[model samples]
Target: MDPELLTIVVMNVMNTTRLVLHYFMSCETENDSVVPALLAAMETNNSRLLLAFTEQLHAVDRRYWARETSTEWWDRIVMHVWDDEQWLQNFRMRKSTFLELCAELAPALRRKDTRMRAALTVEKRVAIAVWKLATPDCYRSVAKQFGVGKSTVGAVVMQVCRAINRLLLRRTVTLGNVQEIIDGFEAMGFPNCGGAIDGTHIPILAPDHLAREYINRKGYFSMVLQALVDHRGRFTDINAGRSGKVHDAHIFQNTGLYRKLHSGTFFPDQKIPMGDVEMPIVILGDPAYPLLPWLMKPYTGKLDSSKERFNNRLSRCRMTVERAFGRLKGRWRCLFGRLDLDEENIPMVIAACCILHNICEVKGEKFPQEWSAEVERLAADFEQPDTRAIRGAQCVAIRIREALKEHFDHDSQ
Candidate 1:
């Protein structure tokens, strides 16, 4: 075997062992309101039982892999249970309701003999277990964090995503805030602006030989996350596909969002006509997108026409999408780097964040001050130009500036 290959194998084995050990013996820290409730279901002397289970983990490791490592490894595991006693006491969720819900969904959820079975009572325990996995760490890390086996960590993630996806099936569009988002754009100098359209890169390690295909000029392998925002910087549509190597135009053509303007009924038995009535759904783009009639790009040429003025203001409004992506990836530094999962799981997790972001925005929830500040700070970096990657990047930049010559270009009319 190649020396590099041998090194990787050895490193993987060492990391695996450390993560598994971490799972068993990590000391607890503070829990948010949710973690405590998750811990509440444990019976008396649960810690003592947990410690004994850690001991049994050694036996299971020996029997399964015949690689007798260390019981001392178990001593290294950490738990955060002591951080919030009040939270545990006050946490409320009907254990019966959860069990009944679980019974309806998957009866095999908590077989006492199963490794994934909860040490605590609240159904939120399972949900929390699922949540700890938002980071793309190995199951060993997640297992270590949640005090369960690696296999259990994997199962919890899959189950939670599928379960949540199904339960949240009736997600209506957030057009309720559409007017507010549009209002934000109007204030920012873009009127009647529907949303900003842009793409983001999510880093993930290469999975196989074809992994090279996913790598981009950014010096990392990534998947492009494309989003369409409403006038107020609220997300209206998101599609995660196409590796970083694919151009923005290719992604736009494939997305099929334009079809919505052409098809579908509005109310009972009222069939909408199919004639090409150009109801303008402004998809504000930089020159990276095509100059189609419906989708507007910034103007780069001399400001002589109504189109030039329109592009100018359109560019300014569309900027919010770029800033939003900057805020999201910069605040979540984990997203700025590589993810651990295969490509398939990557999209699911990315989709979950997009969904959660809209949900949180709708709920008016905010992250800590530090993250908020980071978002504002790193935002300028996103607007910086790349002269090399895009041949017409400079010309497009010119077009955007020209397009912004006036707000809405009504002077031409």
Candidate 2:
């Protein structure tokens, strides 16, 4: 085993234990217990560890208090403090010490002084919630492990999403970032492939009026999650619009994602002025969406060549998005299990996962991003080849799909 990797593992466990003790601290009792636990965990060559870990623990606590002045006001080192209405909120023991630390960076996060400057500090509360929900684990298990209630977990996820929107979204993603992502795919040999746009389906329990409209061909109630990903497969845009029953093409048209094609703009023009060019952004399809000047689809060929192989390769690259979607759905069972979230909150959850999936792509999480947000997001069914049917009967749909596919296939040679 690699020594560094092993050290990391041991450190992670030690950190967890240390955080737990903060919540359950008795300075005298903990002082008594610390040396023995360190000695118990020591290897034969490690007599110095008892003193070493204790010093490390104290240093960590000092740093914690240095950053959060209210750490000293808590009953235990693990106590949580919040400020609202400029008054001291009750000091409560954090069920999960690690989570509290993870969220303590925001200015208004926790303090004994507690005169509330903000009702919700988006950074500490919402951002961490988003991180937790995107990760794979049972909420109850998460609560038990982290020491928070399930409802708090849910609330935190929502808050994290809000924090991100207010803070990180613009910092990390730019129209320039979108263009750079497109360039990466072009270098991989997919020309004019600004990005691939597709819709996903997420299952939902019955809604009041939209019950029948939400029944998809998959024979379930679902909502459509439309997304835009570049050739390199990073998600630049996503739209969780319409019910599952709405066709992919309609979801595109109705949600105004398709409007970009007609309006001569294929990407978000939010705030910063983007040049008005009919930038070509292609969508890989199995025959469902309408063909527009900005879109393209694969051409079936009589014989396979480098060009054919190239198309196959391009398809393979674009598949990164679909793979991401599959992993996302698989990690969160609550998403697959009767999601009765308020209608507005659904997209926020999907967006949070998409952001993390993009981060994980630094390691290239398998094949590609998934387009199955409606059926199964971040889905990777290794046994099944990537192929699916398309349905486009609207005059808009039929003309758009056929035209774009022909244009792209012909250009490939």
Candidate 3:
């Protein structure tokens, strides 16, 4: 009840009692017993009025101040009842993998209980973050499902994303066993290939400042993710959060991979004899990337049978990276839609998703066939503008491509 209204009611009750007492006193004619009886009656009436007001106030309190507790979906269904298939369907990981992830992230995600409320458990926190990443549900919906506040959902996501990048990124997304990677490519019919490099755009909301810079050739706001994946569809390196307007080749040149390849510090010194030239280990890229001595791209313009066969074989080897990206976006559907996050934090989210992808791939988790349907539509491949390469470098790249073509032709014969 409003305080002013309560005050008015009390005042009216008191005034009525006083008026009755005054009228009884005025009408009294030497009758002391009558005044006493009337005073007792007034006291009883005032007590009843007070009791009624108290009950009304209690009713108002129950109506407006009650708290509605959540249904405890995470505690009831996800923790105890969900099977492995249910876990994969919702969280995009098996039950064992989810527990392992929580254990690994517990050091960073663990929180202390305060007097205000008990802190969310590490498993619950990780589940909240993974649920948000694996699905396109909004924060409020996620909060409702997890029985946490909407803001808590957003905070837990950033917290877990940061933890994953800090602890697991370097270990998971690394160039482990380079010789094995090369051998895998060899089995795929591409000789001396280490990894395949490609770029895809991740959609994001228009920023408050310089929003135009984020718009890609597809005319949608996005951030660029440049990745290097080995032959088994695992990411070896990732560079994310550049503006979509930037070209792939430009982004590649700015990365540490470019520096390592330029300084000859990335790969081993082993080389294979191919006709007059010895071919060093190289990475495969598309025409959008510049041709370098250590980077092999498909032949452009008119091609003879040998060049065509070489392009076909190189493309076959490069498809690993493409499929890796498809699975990444397919499993983590958050990347398929515009991320509702700040531009600065977008990179961490992307990095965390890539790390999770590698973990799932290394663990041999199954990718659902239904998820792949969205890959072709959501994967935006921008056409890069013409890039200028040094004539000396271009000549070396041309010789390497020609030599690889001859090698493929000889194999075909």
Candidate 4:
């Protein structure tokens, strides 16, 4: 037995003995008829306390006596044997990129070694988290592969995910070089376009509270991940944790992105002349989003050749966001299956995945062809939400869409 644990047990026993002695002395001065009842009550209380203490000591003893698990798989196979390709296959990032992330997250995830056990190394902790996110394995499977306790795997995942969100999310998933994004979109035939926005459902275990709210139109429990991506299919901003039943427009309107765009603060003042109207920078969305001066969704109802051409162009550009999401879930296969984490922690994990996606993309990591097929299959499973266009469209927004249609028409000629 550990000296500290032995000392603690001895102290508890002494305190209980002293307490019993005091009770007996007090009961001696009480009525003779009441003495038996008092002793009975004290005996019951002491038995309960002793049972609880005995259980706790057994638990501590089991923990102390358990031999440390061998980490041969992680120590030898992963550390010494794997190459860059293997790392990318398993972790979805190259060894160099993984090291960079470990360094970035070290401050938050690093733990001190205790008397009983050595703390997990920073690299190992990060690897455990990334593997959990990148693959569909449950905690038990992950623990077995990594040679750690199942609970340790879960704790390490949350710790690393929270660290990634706290340290990297804002910096990695932001709109960078706005003019460059606009230029990229213009080259793709959408003038003055800043980004493409869309939403997808991330499947999750049904939460205990308000479980029905998470069921989407498709009849599965999920949370909405609304994302805005630049021309290169990199996420610029993401809004997650919204109930799956919510509309895309509703989620969009509630985001800080909406506020920034509405207040004319999201984009730069750059504009291009389309006949008499000066077109402000805009983001392209599908018909699910409302048409605004800053947001251009496709025209609904019957359309002529010119309007059709505009919608086609917009759809092509908006595919950036869709493909971004496809790649996101494709790389992080855990997102394809229902996440088994607590509802509160799911958002952090999602954000961490996005941050990692950006890193992999920016680093020019090659996405495997096999993952693309999985993404397509995942896409086919979900039905599109019913489009509910907001009523009372602004005249300026109408003019902007019309002007863009005419521009496409003239450009085709």
lDDT winner: 4
Candidate whose TM-score is highest: 4
lDDT of 4 by residue, 239-358 (tens): 899999898899999999999999999888888887678889999988788888889988878888888899899998999998898889889988888889899989889988899999
Comparison by TM-score, 2 against 3, better one: 3
RMSD score of candidate 4 (Å): 8.2
Off by over 4 Å in 4: 1-68, 380-387
Compute the lDDT of residue 186 as modeled in candidate 2.
Answer: 60
Tally clashes: model 3: 0
TM-score, one value per model: 0.58, 0.54, 0.84, 0.84
lDDT of 1 by residue, 24-85 (tens): 44556564454444445333235555465556555452424433323232223212232233
Clashes of each: 24, 38, 0, 0
Task: For candidate 2, write residues 1-413 as lDDT tens digits.
Answer: 44445457557766766665565453455367775665455432243544555555555523223122221322233234443211111111123422332353354333343565324333335333643553445555544434446676676666655554554454433334555765676676554456666666776677776578877776677777677766555566677747776667666767655676568575543221113223345555434554444555544435345435545755765676675455555433345544556776776666655654554444333332332443343233212222243432444433443443344466565
Overall lDDT per candidate, in order of appearance: 0.52, 0.51, 0.87, 0.88
Ranking, lDDT, top scorer first = 4, 3, 1, 2
Compose the digit string of candidate 3's lDDT tens values, residues 57-129: 7666443543455746778877899899998888888999989998999999999999978899999889999
After TM-score superposition, what is the CA distance of residue 203 in candidate 2 from its true location, in Å?
A: 2.4
